[model samples]
Target: KTTTAALIEITTTTATTTKTTTTTTITTTTTTTTATTTTTTTTTTTTTTSTSTTKAPIFNVNMLNNGDAETGPCETDSNVMNPPGWTCNGEITQLAYNNTFIYSRVNTIPGTAPGGCLFYGQISGYTSMWQTIDLTNYADPSLIDTGTVEFNLSAWLGGFINQNDRAGVSVTFLNQANQTTGSVTNIGPVTDTDRGSVTSFLFRQATGFVPVGARSATVLVYIIRAAGNVNDGYVDNVNIFMYQ
Candidate 1:
């Protein structure tokens, strides 16, 4: 009986229980960039100019080295005419038979001792004579550019013994068209003497003459015999220049 009661109490007891839960977290990052630009420039410049040229004179008459003779109707003898290489183009007889020539002459006339040759013509009938030479072909006005003309004259009135025989010389400018541009008179009448056979006269005068629409110009020489009664006068050493 005691053994049966102990087995029944041992069959008596056992018990068990379970539960689960979850959670999560996150992080982020960012980046930025920038750019710049530049520019350049340049410049330039230029210039210009002009020029000109000149030429020389063509004709020059130096009455030096007497080599001319006289030819005209004024004197009773052939001695009244201009020398060779010259011409008798003025009045046949006026104011004691005036004679003239170009380049050279004998410079003789009785009572007119030391006669001055007429390089240019004379104004017919007038007490004084006026003559002109053609300088058209010689001067190139266009090529002249610029310059000055000059000359020298020495006259002896009466055989260098007296100053009674009066005379004068002048300079004139001419154009290609054979026209007068300007003139300078009374440059000389300087009395000469046998002892002082020649008096010096200088002409550095400016022509200040221009040719109208012409490509050339000329220098004219005029000799005037004023006194009707006197010994012959003489002219020597004529020259000219282009100043430019």
Candidate 2:
């Protein structure tokens, strides 16, 4: 029994042991962003200038060609009434006085006229000087339609010291049918009354208006020698003006 009790105590003396272990975990995070940009540019420029356009109408006017008779017929001057741009309704002869050729009363003697080289016109018989002004396209028809336009006609006429010759000037406004739209007449600027009264000269002026629907103006400058060639008259510096 004693042996048996000793073996039981030895068996009870057997022991048991226990052990524990721990583990740790770690984490890391990161973020990134990218951007792009662009730009543009522009440019500009400017300039300026000046001009002239305010002159009066009187200084700048001419409806017909060669109205001044400066060119053609002669190198210097002539008495032939058949000038360019003008129709010779009749014939005239070139008459010279004191060595000055009769173109329009160019004085042969110095200090006689405004200029020594004056022109003398010898109109014989029933000869006439005629021209046409084309108002159909160039004129301000609106002004004429309202009877507000005026045509001014003028001329320098003279007598050869005791000449019985007389001349007359007239203007006729015509329609497209060639009919009279308006007219102005100074029939006998004759020897005693209008012309040849002075050694200098006479200036006669007539004014008229363009009738509505008129397209043209026909100018007639004529001379009448009452009896013989002694009726020969002179004319010079014919002018026509149009305005208000």
Candidate 3:
């Protein structure tokens, strides 16, 4: 009967949770932080250099034509003494150095000429010859006008033994009109005393600055016979050169 009394008994249930908060604190703080960096590069360059040079002009050539007296017909007689490049006055003869009529000995001339012949004044009186050179063909007009050009005039002059007979060479600078512009430059008249009274040639030269406004030149060769049937005044190796 007690059991049947009634099952009206109520049961109370309590649920307790011991949260083992392992606090894994995995704090998955997914803090997504991203850093960006930029880099720059620099470069250098090199270069090669070069140099240039210029050459100067040469001015050592002789400007006078037939300066050696080897061109054209040459003869031993005064009547046939017509040199190609010159104008003659008195008997201007081209004779071989070994002419038996005048030189008794072979090659009377101490020095040898290019053509074995040399200029000789064959007359008893004064004999003269000349040649005109056009500077326009050999040098710049400005150089002459500015007085910057220089000249070298040279010749071999000789005379007979103990005689006053002598040979000479000279230059006369002229303007375009052929008028004289400067004093004469001479290099000869080799006196008997200068040649030691011997029959031999002597080298003579004259150098000077060209006169201003000079455009042409006249080369004069002369012989003065003092005492001999044959002038015996010899000339050879005439030369003229221009330089800066």
Worst 10 residues of 3 by lDDT: 51-60
Q: Candidate 1 on 110-147: residue-level lDDT in tens?
A: 33323333322233222232334443344445544243
Off by over 4 Å in 2: 1-69, 74-81, 93-123, 187-190, 193-197, 227-231
- RMSD value for candidate 1: 12.2
| Whole-model lDDT values for every prediction | 0.35, 0.55, 0.79
Which ranges in model 3 have alpha carbons more than 4 Å from their true place?
A: 1-58, 77-79, 112-114
Higher-scoring candidate on lDDT, 1 or 2: 2
lDDT of 1: 0.35
lDDT of 3 by residue, 1-244 (tens): 4565666768777879787866555556687778767777676667767754333323667666666667776674335465667888877777666565576622655864556778888874988889888887777676577788889999898888888789999999999888999899999899999989888889999999889999889999998998968787888889888888
| Residue 53 in model 2: lDDT | 42
Task: Give the per-residue lDDT digits (tens) of candidate 2, residues 1-244.
Answer: 4565444544456566555565656555555555656565555555556663433333225454543344344223334535556677555433334333443333432222232222223434667668888774455555467787777777655555555566666778887798886655453364644433444456777766667878788777777766544334655556676777
RMSD of each: 12.2, 9.7, 10.2
Identify the candidate with maximal lDDT: 3
> Which residue pairs collide, candidate 2?
104-119, 104-120, 105-118, 105-119, 105-120, 106-118, 106-119, 106-120, 107-118
Q: Lowest summed lDDT over 10 consecutive residues: which window, candidate 2?
A: 109-118
The CA lDDT at 27 in model 2 is 56
* Sort order, TM-score high to low: 3, 2, 1
Error at 243, model 3, angstroms: 0.8
TM-score of candidate 2 versus the correct structure, residues matched by position? 0.59
- lDDT (0-100) at residue 161 of candidate 2? 51
